[model samples]
Target: MRKGFLKNRFVRVKLPALLFATVTVNRGLMR
Candidate 1:
């Protein structure tokens, strides 16, 4: 149960951060 909770929290935080980083890198390449 605790492992599941930590996994959920990790996804909630890292998912958006990874997405944003991807977007920023793409934009930089497009320039």
Candidate 2:
């Protein structure tokens, strides 16, 4: 359970960066 909690926290930390990267890629492709 503790391991899963740490994994979830790691994802929560990374999710925004991933999202931002994807959005930037899409915008670049659109241009």
Give the whole-model CA lDDT for all candidates, comma-separated.
0.98, 0.98
Candidate 1: segments with Cα more than 4 A from true spot? none
Tell me how far the alpha carbon of residue 16 in candidate 1 is from the true structure, in angstroms, after superposition.
0.2
TM-score of 2: 0.68
State how far residue 18 of model 1 sits from its true place (Å).
0.2
**What lDDT is reached at residue 14 by model 1?**
100
lDDT of 1 by residue, 1-31 (tens): 5999999999999999999999999999999
**Residue-level lDDT tens digits of model 2 in 1-31:** 6999999999999999999999999999999
Output the worst ten-in-a-row residue range by lDDT, candidate 2.
Answer: 1-10
Q: TM-scores of the models, in the given order?
A: 0.89, 0.68
Best by lDDT: 1
